[model samples]
Target chain A: MKVYNISFQIDPDLEFQWLEWMKNNFIPSLMSTKSFTENKFYQIKVNADQSPTYTLQLYCDNIELWQAYQELQANDHLKELQYTWGEKCYYFCTEMQIVN
Target chain B: MKVYNISFQIDPDLEFQWLEWMKNNFIPSLMSTKSFTENKFYQIKVNADQSPTYTLQLYCDNIELWQAYQELQANDHLKELQYTWGEKCYYFCTEMQIVN
Candidate 1:
């Protein structure tokens, strides 16, 4: 299986709105792509720090599916989010091949 | 090899200081543990978001080495960082058994 992790650094001022949008809209739209086998989201909390961090992980059977999802992001739906979130969000994509 | 990921959500107000400390202090101490085979740090950027996010990944030959590093964190050096960073930092540890 291949695991892909995408992390977001969010502005504290827009934390609530970001979470709401991600939960209600962003994630669902990604899921609709039907390319992922498992998906999970994490809300990271810093002890006394006020910074907002969130992680989205998707598990796919292979890189092909992931590539397909990436291609779909070209659509208008994902583009809208890209513009809405703008610079307030940053993400990194890593491909992991599980070895146990 | 075993791959471990630790992510931190940092306060924007403490961004520069935090980065400096991690680069100079926390990370060096982690390296001193002498258990990790490879270590990397990533500074994540969010487009318009003001939040700060960082990730630390350690590669080990086995879980035992990882456990040793965890044990070392109990020392005074690591604790000092824990106290200094306090609530300003958040982290998650995930173990990945690479399968290619």
Candidate 2:
């Protein structure tokens, strides 16, 4: 499986909203897309900033599916996040192929 | 549970040796320590450079166990890797707490 990992740095004031939106709305919509087989969320143990860092991992069967999600659905979700949170949150993404 | 994620950028020429060493020696020794419950390896899907980027994630029950592993055995293994590969391999690490 291939994992699409998105790590975010979020303003402390918006942490609860971010978590709620991810758990209730974002993830559910992502699941509805049927591209991801599994998903996980994580909080980074070390962060220098006052803000919090989080990671969201979405696992898919192959690169093609992940690519499809990126091309077709990523922008909308990204836009939604940007519109809602603006500068309160920012993120970077990485994709990994499981070898073990 | 907690995940200790190590990401590496290794010279492509030494990729096979790195993988073999990780599978044969490093991971085995890590598991033998009884500090980690599980581990996984992955190759990042996107790269602008010629080198291959990989991630190794070790899971443990808590921060204390991970700290124990880090304080007790990490440097020795790190030294062995550096001694063997030198500048050909370099890495960064992050720790994350499972939130969902």
Candidate 3:
């Protein structure tokens, strides 16, 4: 299986609103695509030098499926988020393989 | 190698300040312990129902070293964070085994 680890930097002032939007809209839309098998959201911790953020761990059967989701649907999803968050958010994606 | 994925939810209003703290204080403190082999931070993506966050992916030689870190020093680290963020932060930790 292939796993994608995605992180986001959100505006602290609008955190609750952003969470509501994601639960009501973003997650469902992505799950509905049929390419992903499972997805989990995580709340990050703030250390002495940084504020907290959010994480989405997506599991797919293979890299091809992940690529399909990205190439076919990610842009639209990203556009929607950009409209809502504007410049208050930043993110990165990493691919992982399970060994045990 | 064993990998630990740590995610945190921080106060958005204090993000920049927090980032500076992490870069200068928290991260340095952890690295000083000399147990973690490598570490990388990622800005998470926010979906419809979630807000942006941060992730710390730490690499080590094995689970024993990770355990040493937790039992030896994690509590102090956590306490420092508590002092800074109060109730505006949350986090989760996951262990991953690399396959490739």
Candidate 4:
């Protein structure tokens, strides 16, 4: 399996409200697409900045499926996030290969 | 559950051999301590440097167990890795809360 992770650092002021929105709206909308088999969300404990950091992990059967999601759905989802939060949230994506 | 992640960026020249050592020795030794419930290894697909990066995630029921492992076993394990590989490998640690 492959894990497609999107890690985000959000403005502290919007943390609570943003988290609720993500859980109730954003993540559900993404999952509805059925491109992933499993998903996990996490708060990475690092104090690099005043903003809080979190990661959303979406697991799929293979890279091809994830690539397909990227081609078909990723841009829309990301666009929505950017359009909603703007500078309040910043993110980076990483593709990880499960070793064991 | 909590994930204690150790992320390493290793000299590309030692990638193959070091991976073999980690899969066969380091990870197993860490597991033997039984401080964690589950573990996963991954290579984050990023090309920020000449070195290749990998992560070892150890899952435990809580932070206390991980703290115990850090107090009793972590140092020795890290020392062994350092003694064996020296400047060939560099790493950082992160503690994360599973949100989903």
- Pick the lDDT winner: 4
Candidate 3 is graded, for docking, as: incorrect
lDDT of 1 by residue, A1-100 (tens): 6666766778888889988898888877777877888776766544447467767767778677777776766255546666988877765555444422
- Regarding DockQ, does 2 or 3 come out ahead? 2
Residue range A6-83, candidate 2, lDDT tens digits: 888898888998899989997788878889999889998765655799999888986787788899998898788788
- Which residue pairs come into collision in candidate 4? none
TM-score for the A chain of candidate 4: 0.92
- Model 1 RMSD vs true structure: 11.0
Superior candidate under DockQ, 1 versus 2: 2
lDDT of 2 by residue, B32-54 (tens): 98889999899997556658989
Better of 1 and 4 by TM-score: 4
| Candidate 2 deviant stretches above 4 angstroms | A62-64, B62-64
Kindly report the fnat of each predicted structure, to 2 decimals: 0.00, 1.00, 0.00, 1.00
- Model 1 chain B: weakest 10-residue lDDT segment is B91-100
Give RMSD (Å) of candidate 4 vs. truth.
1.7
Candidates sorted by TM-score, best first: 4, 2, 3, 1
TM-score of each: 0.49, 0.90, 0.52, 0.93
Give the chain B TM-score achieved by candidate 2: 0.89
Candidate 2: residue A50 lDDT (0-100): 52
